[model samples]
Target: MTREIENAAGIPVVQIATIVPIMLTVGANRIVPGVAIPHPTGSPELGKAGDKATRRELLLRAFKAMETEITYQTVFE
Candidate 1:
């Protein structure tokens, strides 16, 4: 898996997924809560501006998560 490879390579990975619980179950260390499965970064119902803002926020969270060091799995909302 990609996560496994990243972990083996010592790469700080930020995974974005609609199902945070599932990602956690699978041992994902850094996770960004996504809008949905179909649109992980943006939502169609939120319109252009809202979707863009949401994506930006998620990306920012991911960046922060990447910067922080953790011994266990972490989920960024």
Candidate 2:
């Protein structure tokens, strides 16, 4: 709903969700695949270093997604 509103208001929004498939089904145009439902940014079990890397990767993908143009729902892995 937030995404829809933002888009409607001419605000380009990037959605980060653990469930990429579901977001795609709901017609989200820009999405970043989250690490998990509980820890969408990083996983505690991955240790500090690994968790930081995962978070960095997601952030990079999100920035890339924002720069890229798309006609349909797109997910950055």
Candidate 3:
């Protein structure tokens, strides 16, 4: 689906998922390692402020992944 969106629509995609191996196996070109399965961006245990910070960091990484040029599948861990 990611490849199809990129290929057919000409839009770069960054996939944020906890199951990195599965995304890679499925041929996701740009992947970001999510924090957890339930909460893929922020950790609830970190409290409000910390969770916000973590989420920000994850978003930044995802943006970076979208900006990067790659010939094959890559993980922004």
By TM-score, highest first, what's the ranking? 3, 1, 2
The 10-residue segment with the lowest total lDDT in model 2: 2-11
Model 3 lDDT tens row, 1-77? 88788889887899888999999898889999998999998989999999999999999999999999888899888
Worst 10 residues of 1 by lDDT: 1-10
Full-model lDDT, candidate 3: 0.91
User: Per-candidate TM vs. native?
Assistant: 0.88, 0.83, 0.92
Most accurate candidate by TM-score: 3
Question: Judged by TM-score relative to the true structure, which candidate is superior, 1 or 2?
Answer: 1
Ordered list by lDDT, greatest first: 3, 1, 2
Backbone clashes in each candidate structure, one number apiece?
Answer: 0, 0, 0
Q: What ranges in model 2 sit over 4 Å off?
A: none
Clashing residue pairs in candidate 2 (N, C-alpha, C atoms within 3 angstroms): none
Per-residue lDDT value at 46 in model 2: 88
Per-residue lDDT tens digits for candidate 1, residues 1-77, read 64796779989889999888898888788988898899999977989999999888989999999999888888776
lDDT of each: 0.87, 0.82, 0.91
Please provide, for model 2 over 1-77, each residue's C-alpha lDDT reduced to its tens digit, 9 standing for 90 to 100. 84677568876578888988888787778899887899999978989999999888888888898898887777776
